[model samples]
Target: MPAAATVNSPRHAMSDTLNQPTSFSAIDFLRTKSLANVVQAEIERMIIDGEFQPNERVNENALSQRLGVSRGPIREACSALAAMGLIEIIPNRGFFIRALSSDESQDLSEARAGIFGCMAMMLAERVTVAQIAILRALLARMDEIVALGEVHTYYPVNLEFHKQIASMAGNNRLGSIYQSFVRELHIQRYRALSSPDVLHISNAEHREIVDAVEARDPVRALIAGRAHILNGIVRAKKAQQAGEATAQAKAAPRRTRRTAAAMEETAAGTPADAATKPRARRGGLSKTD
Candidate 1:
């Protein structure tokens, strides 16, 4: 065949290869990411809200049904969460909710403190009067909750107050990072704020942040924001210690009871084997008379 004829051939080998459809493309990748993002958000909410407890296996089938999506999206979501330290994937056993270690929790808290401080600083410079009013209203509502000693009720509202701060800060990247930390610290945050005193203290810190922001004092606001979370670390530690003491106290009684039972057994002076064996007569024989 002439060179011109070969160049224009319809059945060219290169053309056939080029025309073959790819198994996956950019469109497919984007669609998968979109679906997985939805799944990831829902499952993240479940874990952070304690709907799915720590160390519990993630039920992909249940999630797929609930979200009305396939297991592929659910698995993809779980893998993403695992990367965020919200879940763990083990070979053969599947994904489970991750429980942060003490050090891990502290590291997350400190990083969150930094993010929150930055948000407060940014808000102080650019915050509107309406935002201040919103925060003040949240604080007022929190005061009522504190007075009523409603830890459970106060916790969600506290979350909202901080969320509003993040949103108002107007930095999407910072807000996203702050929210991730919040999710990771949910368990510890709840435990810390479970106390009435802690609730009062937390609300007071909220006031400090609002006060500084209202006055347009970024330094004060930064300090207040960092202090709020760092103080929470203190409260969290105390709460954990107190909980441990209570557990030890409760376990102490059981341990004492076990000890007493063991002592009583020893006092009875009857061995199980001794009961089964024949008693020797005259110190030497069975004495079959």
Candidate 2:
């Protein structure tokens, strides 16, 4: 018989993808949970905060010693993060955080506009009074955080606002996908909105989006979300440029140390594959470049 016809349905495709197993088992899922998860979470936080600059080696030995764990779990956690696309793996080298690019940022904003707009439209049709009340309370908290200028905590609160809106949109899949981008996207937004003049404008747009959602006006909500995302893209590019400039200045001294390490390693004539390898991504978040 000819090869069986593939199920082309969206539901079937999503089910197949989500059901795929990771490299580890549940009981042993977190062998030495405290150390591995702690290291993973801390590294993730650094990526979100832009501390461990993108596209740079994540030293397994260094992190292993720092977190007081064997290289095995550290390697496992790095593998998990690579699976999440928060980091990238290069042949003959270790993992590095994914970098930002102008085109990629534009594409992401467009994707957010499309997905979030669909969500808002669905939510408007099904939203209850109680849901609106809950959202209003959350927005109030965001406003308070913004007013206090507690920059760090503002991101989590901001993510909560988006998550609530996504949940209200009545699509679990959309919400799950949106949640994945929470770390990177929020960091981008925070960087862009750091300026005093731009900060209030972003807050105003957020309020507008909430108002639209409350009014059950999908079109307005869609427009508001799109405008917000595009503005964020512009601001992020500016911020990333400034940040990269600062980082380059700091990299001058570190460059010499890195060069020496690379030369020493080369002189040893060790095979590159001895290092941790990055898993090949079949496809999902289309690899751009």
- Using lDDT as the measure, the top candidate is 1
Clashing pairs in 1: none
lDDT of each: 0.88, 0.73
Reference-based TM-score of each model: 0.73, 0.67
Residue range 22-42, candidate 2, lDDT tens digits = 633543556756566767887
Query: Which runs of model 2 end up more than 4 angstroms from their true locations?
Result: 1-38, 181-187, 244-289
What digit string (tens of lDDT, one per residue) describes model 1 on residues 69-167?
A: 999989998999888888889899999998889999999999999999999999999999999999999999999999999887998899999999999
- RMSD of candidates 1 onward, in order: 12.2, 20.7
Candidate 1: segments with Cα more than 4 A from true spot? 1-46, 49-53, 56-80, 269-289
Question: Candidate 2 clash total?
Answer: 0
Clashes in each model (backbone N, CA, C under 3 Å)? 0, 0
